[model samples]
Target: MSELKNSPWITCFLRPQELLLLLMLRWAIAYMEDPAFPHLGDSSQPLPRACPWRCSCPRDDTVDCAGLGLSVFPDNITKAARHLSLQNNQLQELPYNELSRLSGLRTLDLHSNLISSEGLPDEAFESLTQLEHFYVAHNKLSVAPQFLPPSLRVADLAANEVVEIFPLTFGEKPELRSVYLHDNRLNNTGLPPNTFLGSEAITTLSLSSNQLSYLPPSLPSSLERLHLQNNLISKVPRGALSLQTRLRELYLQHNQLTDSGLDATTFSKLSSLEYLDLSHNQLTTVPEGLPENLTILHLGRNCIRQVEAVRLHRARGLRYLLLQHNELGTSALPAGTLRPLRALHTLHLYGNRLERVPPALPRHLKALVMPHNRVAVLGERDLVSARALAELNLAYNRLASERVHPGAFRRLRALRSLDLAGNQLSRLPEGLPPSLRSLKLQRNQLRALEPELLAGLKKLRELSLAHNRLRVGDIEPGTWHELQALQVLDLSHNELSFVPPDLPEALEELHLQANRISHVGPEAFLSTPHLRALFLRANRLHMTSIAAEAFLGLVHLRVVDTAENPEQVLVQLPPKNKGALSPKG
Candidate 1:
């Protein structure tokens, strides 16, 4: 090949039509193969898009057409290049003999096309015994029999028309490890008991969003991950699921899994099950005899009123718990109920009937979502000690005071964001964490903001004080000066008569949707370097006041949401340009 590269006879021996045919074949082959534009060494600037035919290089071994939307598979592609991809196109069929000549081919991807099963080159793939990594997703395959590769390791046939599958469908491809059969028309009954008989070493099987009503009576024992979500499975067989003892992740969400019918003994055999999701069901209570090795458990959006912690206490390794929108009403959680969950990171208890905040929490609790509860007040005395808590969402609770305990959040050294929106706060609690970056305190009855109240939050970014009783007398420069990183400020839905010039640098994404902000000072955000995505949805300010240059410093500003009050934004971007921005308010 090196000697040929230096030969002028090599260029002389090749005909232009022969070169063109070989190049077109190579181009057809290369055009079908998807390759992300490469960067120079470690640099980030992507290479410009172009086909290899456009390159001045003398080599005719490579073709590239990654983003072109071509129709009809390129003809005689295999005679030149070994890899082929026609990604992001509307091609209907594969050109005849185009895939056969590429005996040296290793990959073929017809991703995002209209190639149905008939259009699929059924016999062509079996000939490429040297082929590996076949991806034909988002196509029209009605069954799993058309394409078969004995030396396959990964077969992604998702989002197809496969209606049924048989055990011999794989036909003893023992090396196959991953099979993606999700979003197909296959049902549980359509698969035979030994459907996974020969493929015993397969690990991941995704049948989610299919017609599977229950687990097949038998499955591969080496199965590690089984995704059966969004199906009509009402009952999991007792002996049917005992084979997959090594299964780690099991997704059963959006199914009609009833507590009365599911045999507890079936799940008892899965000793390695770590993740379990049983959300969005009609069960009144969970079945007993849960696995002891489970780690993550999700039982949200159900009719469960009572929780028996003793059954789950055996899972000493349980980490994350999600019990939202349940009826854990008024009942006291048993002592040491969640105490053993030492590895717990996130516990969601929102939309419950608990009238009192629990005084005990895990040592590793990071995110506590307890919004929309019946608790009327909150302070350090009621909140459990979670020094590592970073995001606390206690919005929409009935609180009337702002005198939270001085040490309420001082211990949370890592606390960065807090959402107290839709409360009845008259003032901010004392001693908030200084590391906070985002604060949401809208829809309250506070009369004004005390500039001295917030002097230590140096990392504050987005603060929404909308829907309050704010006034110009409440303004102070220290409040804005202390927030060195303030990007978005929402002071709308207040009684402000004059727009204050107190915002510091980097005040982008401001939301003054509804207020009496009659004037936006010329230097309102003079120092703001990256101000963008503003929302003055509603105010008494006129359109002319917001001259074309009124937003002069915001070179990065692209979207301004003013749709909530048409009279306010239309008074600004008049006539009919109001329909262009994202949904406002």
Candidate 2:
């Protein structure tokens, strides 16, 4: 012991208190050297502490206390947290001077909470100078915050009871880019004139689903996308959108806009505009002076009676045009009205009073939906220019099979989906497009699918013939043999006494409900090995009539709806066959 004490390194045995202090000093030095350690003793930065009890520290700079039912903020939150999420919680208020300690916080999500106007004190967000994103949507705040951090880039207060926004709420933040205040109660009186005048960097704004009766003229010039749908807006003042040259998208659907309410030059200055939706209004004619760069326009569900060709002459780059549910007739659209839209791809004119297809359809049209019209004939030249058409929906039209020209669709090599349901067709249309992948013939008059009708449709995937008078003999043995890729077959509500034979080998879903089928043979589905869903409900299927080997080869079958039959089939099945039967109605 005397020799050890005499050594240089081990001078002597010190007291316990002094030795403990020396060990702590060594640990403090190592802690300070660590690059991940948060600096201590900085008055401006909070000291690092242990993670809160009910919270999680997924990363060194993130704390998540979401959906914890925390009415009061958790304690011991580290000051180094940069992303704190307390959404979907019962937190009604934040403690004063508590959140101000997180000086490095960049994003705070408190959405779906009970934070009211009084609960969110101004100081709660006043100290967060570095905060860039703040979300408090789906809350009970009746008014917006009077002040926000200047560094905020996005503020989402949607689905709140906010009826008023202070003048300085969003005007002072120069760096603010996006503000979502949709589904609020703000009206014209509640919004000041200079609400968004100072935020020059603002690009996206949403004020949809509000009670505003007119367009707000206080929008920032840098806005790129603006959503104002589902409002009481009836008129758009001239130059309301003229200065928004950089704006690309404008949604004004579900409003009370009329022909007289809009100015002739309302949309002439939006040179960069690409999308404009003015559907569900009271317009009697197509709006004039549309933007030249507009690509997609929605004017459906209106009182439009005519489409002036000269008004759309400048929209040469239009790709999609919707004019459904209007009062347009065959003469409303003049000749050569749509020839200028060279880039047009889709045109919808359904639910109209047209007696025939519109003249001078665009040559590059890909989809034409004209269902629920008064057309009685499919003329030869009706679709001659639509060679690039891929989809044609003429359902619920007053057309008969005899009125359709034999070679009406012969040149359409790109046609893939055809809907001729709810027509007076007695048989399948001859010379149907071979590239067809879907054919709907339900709610029609006749029966008997000719073998040659679908002989070339090798790529057909869906065929619906429900609510027809097709019998067992109507569907021949090779009716579906050529459809090598067919996967869905709906023959429900038909006059079939038995299941049709020779189904496609790749059939996966078979709907034969509400038929006159009385018995199921053992080889009913022996050819379809890939069948997964079989619907045989509301038929004449009985427990004893269905052969025991009906589902022998169906290894991958998951659903077998046999309800509404004469007897319970699933209950009578043996214990070993229970897994194969799922009674889904």
Candidate 3:
């Protein structure tokens, strides 16, 4: 070869075109003879300079084509793309070989489309060997798409029309960790035994809003969270969850679970369980054998009549317990039933038939809701142990003012809100906590308000005294002077003939609708400079009684409702301003 190159005949005798062809032939021969040459067939083509039309390439490896109303996938997408989002489009199909070039793709989102099972072929995702997360939710898929990548870790198929899921639908996907199949039509017959036996690595599985009538015993042992809410499941046989020892959360609300269907031994083996939701079921009593580490339990809207202390003794770590809308009565809860719940912080017992409050509440309890009951009395010992209580709701009950003990709420120094509306109270209860910020006393029979009734409520901000029999002399002078923080007061549906005097200067809203007030003067709102809303609707005011400048001092007053009074009375008030007054007829 050196001797041939040294001779000048080859270069001097050949034309330019022939010389180029000779060099190309020599290069090709050298590549064929040498085994160390790298393959350059795929990389020889230059990458596209710009992203596809109507799409954005924020990075060199990401493509966002969401919400484009596209009926077909874009052509010639860069094969180097690792993330592609085509959600909220009109595409209906994912045919085979359509994504063959995107073998390196790791995330693909096709949510909120019209794609069905038939639109996606068996090998639609065969080439995506490196895919990790796949989202196909909110579509029209009637069956599980086949040939999902083995490397997939998360698959979302929620809000679809999938009626059946075969045992091998997720064929041998050992790396799959989360599978969302909620809002489908899957029933017990469609889900055969061992449907999830192959998915050992699945930690979260959502099968909610289905027609399953029984709990499946084929759940994987490594599963940690399972959601089966809004299903028709009526039975949970013994040892149903024996294999799932690592389960931590189970949601079975809105089902047909009864006391007989739920065997206590089924959950004793799940030592790691922390949350359980069995609300809206048919059980007549609290379930037993709950895990000791449980932190939350929801059993609302059931037919449970009793909650025995033994049933909750093992769940010492429970912090939240909801038992509202049941058939429980005063005798249903025995004494010391809640004493073992040392960590309980929130308890909901509203909408029951109890005639008295439960005793021995946890000292650390923060929220206690017991409204819509038949309790007629509130004794001093009702809440003595709840020193840390911040919220207490006892509205819509049969409580009478004479029945409440004077020191019923004196121990609750941390109380901030107290609701006692829709009762038969004739007077204000004594010894109310001074830390109360909100007090609801509406729809009662109170006839007067003395100065001593609100003497220590310096932090009171809102007070509702509507729908009472209070008259002009009901409110004494300086009745609300101590409540410097008072901002809202509602005295509507009363018999008061005039605006009460000595209101707090910080008052922002005053409601006195359906009263007998027939006159108003300019000094009516002189003390309330920050008043923004004043309602005097359905009063007995005449057109000539109200002074034109009655609201002049209220610079912040914007909303005034004087309707249902005479139209002549409305014409006597001052002309409405653009930003100050918005009087309604």
Instruction: Report the error of model 3 at residue 359, Å.
Output: 1.9
TM-score of 2: 0.87
lDDT of each: 0.71, 0.88, 0.87
Task: Rank by TM-score, highest first.
Answer: 3, 2, 1
The candidate maximizing lDDT is 2
| Model 1 spans > 4 angstroms off | 1-131, 146-149, 261-272, 285-295, 332-335, 402-407, 474-487, 501-513, 519-537, 542-585
Structural similarity to truth (TM-score) of each candidate: 0.73, 0.87, 0.87
- In candidate 2, position 396 carries an lDDT of 96
User: lDDT order of candidates, best first?
Assistant: 2, 3, 1
Off by over 4 Å in 3: 1-50, 541-545, 568-578
- lDDT for model 3 comes to 0.87
* Candidate 3 lDDT by residue in tens digits, 130-159: 999999999999988756877989999899
Give the number of colliding residue pairs in candidate 1: 9
Cα deviation at 387, candidate 3, in Å, is 2.5
Local lDDT at 183 for model 3: 98
- Model 1 global lDDT (CA atoms, 0 to 1): 0.71
